[model samples]
Target: MTDTRTDTRASAREILRTLVGRDDADFHEGQFEAISTLVDDRRRALVVQRTGWGKSAVYFVATLLLRRQGAGPTILVSPLLALMRDQVAAAARAGVRAVSINSSNAHEWAGVLEQLRRDEVDVLLVSPERLNNPSFRDEQLPALISRVGLLVVDEAHCISDWGHDFRPDYRRLRDLIATMPAGVPVLATTATANSRVVTDVAEQLAPAAAASASASAAGQPAGPGVVTIRGPLARASLRLGVLRLPDSRARLAWLLSHIDELPGSGIIYTLTVSAAEDTARLLREAGHAVRAYTGQTDTAEREESEGMLKRNEVKALVATSALGMGFDKPDLGFVLHLGAPSSPVAYYQQVGRAGRATENADVLLLPGIEDEAIWQYFATSSMPSEHKAEAVLGALGDAGGRPLSTPALEARVDLKRSPLELLLKVLDVDGAVRRVTGGWVSTGQPWVYDQVRYERIAAARLAEQQSMIDYERTTGCRMEFLQRALDDDTAVPCGRCDNCTAAWYPSDVAVAAASAAAASLDRVGVELEPRAQWPTGVASLGVDVRGNIPVGERLAAGRALARLTDLGWGGPLRDLFAVQAADAAASAAMTSACVRVLADWNWEERPAAVISMPSRRHPLLVASVARALSEAGRLPWLGSLDLVGGGPDGSSGGNSAYRLAAVWNRFEVGAELAAALAPFAGKPVLLVDDLADSRWTLTVAGRLLRRAGTSAVLPFTLALRS
Candidate 1:
């Protein structure tokens, strides 16, 4: 046994040298132990260690050792494309031939499959979402599972519903684990799992016997047991701080004044896409090299941005949480947040991106007053209501094996596209629905909507939010507060935070810089890209629309004074449209801003007339803006379009098809408006509204005006909903 242990150590050392290209390198604390549990004992294990703790090294080393012993290849379930790319490269360095199957590389799947069949691949990296692919799940996955030597679930915290970044697709791993052959070791690893998430994940990774018993009760197969090894969550290299700014302008001023003082290329995280883009624009205009990274960034652009940041070509990537998790940069020098995240676990995870291999890194949070509102939006968006889930299941059941595309399903249900997609994923995980080649179909299985479970999750989320608020207010060690929120029992004052020591950062913003930032943020006009295609299956709703909308009927690219998510005007606009806020005329400041936006708008042709969308709630506000614009621009004020049938009580807010259907025939050009528009034939007309949410109202109203002899319709609104 001694000889065998010595030999194992030697082999691990060799693998480690190959992995890092350094002959003197060795495994970090607990890494070899985790490897031994997988390789020698053939037992499942969970490693909850800080970032850069050699978690990937453990799995790669184990894969190499197991392969040498003639075990089959390791299958790694990764969460992000960026992560998969990095893992593949890292595996290659260790002489482990790795191949990935993800959305971005569909064309290479054939070659990857060929390599897998030939046993030339040592490891295969795939996204958790790939587990639900019909063809792969039914055909490839079973064979791979039968022959696989080990399974690695990277970012394992995502498997838990209690995790900050819970994904329904990750839960589907239970089915795969339950069906795996006994004695095959499985490794689950993450850097961000707190005690609760760890416990939840461990329960899911319970021994095959327990899993079998539970599966038997649930009428499924058993899974494997897991041994968890958790390490200290504290990062000694991070110097944490939180600066409370007066408002968005101050936040921008602080960044502009101090971003260059940051150590190296880092990330500036924002809460919304608009904020990310706006911040990036501001930084760039101020002569800082930055780019926006958000969900809206295309795949190629995202890869380019990642590469630039890695090469230190850009100062920062102003981004949303889209840049979070599995983005590997060993020497990332700093992480600054424009606003606080909703949970401390999440905040810790994001800040963990910094100081991985550095002596010291700065982690700062410029907390904003608007953060809670943004948090509330995301929090509610993620949790599906029972009624919505029931509606989805009912729609699928009524389809009776006929695949229903998401748009078709959207028409049948009241949920919007994003929430509907999330609900479908949850249902798919529960085995009540299946995604096939065309779309989604019912599996004809009875599934319970676990209201109690959902409620518990929601309550936990609220607690996390409260904890984040406390973290901002704490006068003690900020890092300790974060660690404690993660249930880290060893959490203590690090004496490296602003509260523990003195403020290491400059707190004052120069007057000129503050004014410039304020002006940049306050100057709002986001181009509203017109919808070119009508939503599919709207014909089924008796709307008689399909395919691309007629070119002439579509409004040209339009403009809005601001996005409801923008940093500057967003706050006041949100209040203006608040549910309890009493309706009133547009404020003088808002009207003047709208006029300035109109004057600055470089439309192809200046508007010869103006028209308003009849508003039931904000009629006075909408009318005042139109009248203001008409007078300032010296354009004729065509009357507001008459509501033919009550206008569906003002856009209950669902999918595009439903939103369009709600206002399909709800408006008409009255005799006076039609006559007014006829005189402006072949001339541009400004279509004004209080707000633009779905843009369906704009689309329908624009079509009506264009058909009434206007040359083109230019849409302008007080705000655009993000």
Candidate 2:
């Protein structure tokens, strides 16, 4: 009664404390005090929080504090649809009313506006791309300005070119924020952002700091200073290994063998969607649970696969670079690359999906010599041509504001065949034409993806690739280089990569380097995982073994091995020995162990299984062995094993042809095809001249061999070299 105002304030504080206590809210000392200061000062704040940091709490607390002071609902803009959904769910759990406004609900504009006007929604999330919508200003925005007390942008770095995945609309968000009611607060957050981006965002949101109370006096610095966090990048528990391959088939086989180690949680990234689908099909045929994700997959399928991945139903996912944005899964143990990614930014984001919970994880990149060519393709191919652009604009035929299909326009245009697609793509960007169905429609204005700007973007990428190549081949601290590039001052040497591992302890590196060099004489050099039919009574021998008994022993191991060696591997057998035995009884109980040792020893993949029979004149022994080898038709090229008995009549009694199953193994195809395939190790070598005019044939064969395991990949040629 003596002080009614003071009593009311005290009662409100008690109610707030009790509500927070219901959720077991532990007061974070100084956390809210700083936020309260930011609110009181009415300043715009951009916070950079590392992964696992409670960044949401910062904005969350700010929202609650400001709303308590009679400010309006908070407007949060986020780029990801999934993250938005999760936030909505979390809001319900926290007893806060939230509304999401996105393209999906464009028809419900009126109802959403009504809710915003009534102050029924405490938080509203929107996509940046929606700003261009006609209704943003006409019907919905008035309520937004009147009710939006706090403005929050999640993943705010998307506004900068340096961001991992840039979305053009993010840049427009800054201007949109500036249009907010005067004195309304703004807050932004990102898991990663460099200093330049931070400064740029600050300028965008509060350009007129002096007019607002949040601004520091004249030349004074702002309060609640930016805090930079530090942490180690290496997870010591993970064992890292790097393996280089000659082509995709060997890579495929290696992945197939180790797939048991990967589960529904692992990811396999390819350079393109076609490759992803091919790899997925191959894995599926081998009876593994797998799926593929690409930019082109229908939205429904993409969502289903994503749900399956989250539920741990799909064992493996093959995808292009588009699948990795903000995808958080702590159990992801492995991130395997079927090939090198298009860029280091793509590479980093894909690999970062693993080891979220600090559990042991692996990131594997199967680099090949041809990788640079693919990188060059993406770097060079996207450029647009002025000629093409002209053709496109000409196609519009005075219809400036009309929408058209890009494909249809391309068909009508007469530009250089190669650059036409890029030109139309550019026009879509320049806003001259918006993408519609398979074509483009005129937008009455210029856009970025148009022909004129295509070259500029392409040239920039080429330069970036050049820089990446230099960094990739450099002999320096990788983390340091990355840190320097990202403009972070605290990047220390991450002693886990090839270069850092070598630099951290030069003595050990030097010793290992020398040992490797010395051991190279005996080592096979070409590293490959053990083939499926490993250690199975097969001796892959070289034809140079002209000695009768040794040759006989090699021959007896399996005709497949003998044939492979005779094919040309025999030419290099002195330097490289190839043998495989998948039969446990034929070798030992430790087939997997032997394969691991061989992998370390640089042994490559070869068909290594064969049926064996002891030397015996007995008909049953000969007949039984012949039947078994004949039935084991899977190792077709790997000749059958027939241990010759001591008698002169052994050859006559044993039926060598049937026993070896040369007919089944195709040994009977004469030494020519066997000889040709022998060098390939079952892989199809691209016959250039053979497919000079019939490249389609070679392409088909390549697809078939890819489905089969570990086939030799041949180079595209003008004519057959063989």
Model 2 has a clash total of 41
Q: For model 2, how does the per-residue alpha-carbon lDDT over 147-171 read when each residue is reduced to its tens digit?
A: 6788888877666544412455676
Residues 578-676, model 1: lDDT tens digits: 999888998999999999898789998898989999999998889999999999999989889999867757855688887888889999999989887
- Deviation in Å, model 2, residue 434 alpha carbon: 9.9
Candidate 1, residue 399: Cα displacement in angstroms equals 2.0
Best prediction by TM-score: 1
**TM value for model 2:** 0.55
Error of 1 at 133 (Å): 0.7
Worst 10 residues of 1 by lDDT: 213-222
lDDT per prediction? 0.88, 0.49
Clash pairs for candidate 1 = 206-224, 206-225, 207-224, 207-225, 212-222
